[model samples]
Target: MVTRIAKCTCGQLQIVVEGEPLGVGVCHCFACQSRTGSVFAALAAFSPDYRVSGRATDYIRTGDQGARFRFRFCPVCGSNLYHTEEGEEHRSVAVAVGAFADPDFPPPQDSVYDCRRHRWVKLPDGVTVYEKDPE
Candidate 1:
């Protein structure tokens, strides 16, 4: 029942996640790289029942798999905070792991879209990797 707090770069938007996350993963798809402007994006998924205490803006994008995703970001610093996929049961939301700024936070257990993974990027040992989405 540990609660974790995630915040945007500017600290204007804060989210409080209750209990534990359903899953944690890293995505190395082209879309994720472009959206995050990084080699990969790390996320911690929760049951969309968290509490938010600030304003955010939503940006919608279509994934390569043809699924629609709504990305939520802090309006002040434009830091991507969380996202939700279309038709997702439980309305699960994946929060940016970096937003927590806590090294103690659980690490990613899985890696997706590894086909697009950078050649130099090395994942920790024993992590489950997929060439594409696990689904």
Candidate 2:
């Protein structure tokens, strides 16, 4: 039952996610890269009921699969907060790894969209890599 906490740069926004993450991974979609301003976006997915605190602004966007997803962020400091999506089997949210209050969070278990991965980024060996979502 490990709990993870995430906060904004000003500490004005905070959220507590109970239990270990459902999964951890990196997304190399162009949208993720652009929003994170990096090679890819690291994410920790959690169950839908995870407690969320502070005020967050949510923006909706359609993923490559055409499913609707929401991105939450701190309105003031613009810190990326989390993401949520609904589907047939899973309803969950993904917290930005960089927003974690702890710096020792584990690295991702997989790297998705390797075809889109930046030329300069090197992924660790043996990680499950995907050119895109399997489905």
Best by lDDT: 1
TM-score of each: 0.94, 0.90
C-alpha lDDT score of every prediction, in listed order: 0.90, 0.83
lDDT of 1 by residue, 1-135 (tens): 888999999999988888798999999998889989999999999987888889989999987768899898999999999888978836787899999998888888999999999999999988999999977
TM-score for model 2?
A: 0.90
Residue pairs of candidate 2 with colliding backbone atoms: none
Candidate 2, residues 1-135, lDDT tens digits: the string is 787788878777777888878888999999898888888999998877677778888888888788878888889898887878756225677889888956678778988888998888988776899999765
- The true-structure Cα RMSD of candidate 2 reads 1.8
Cand. 2 Cα-lDDT: 0.83
Off by over 4 Å in 1: none
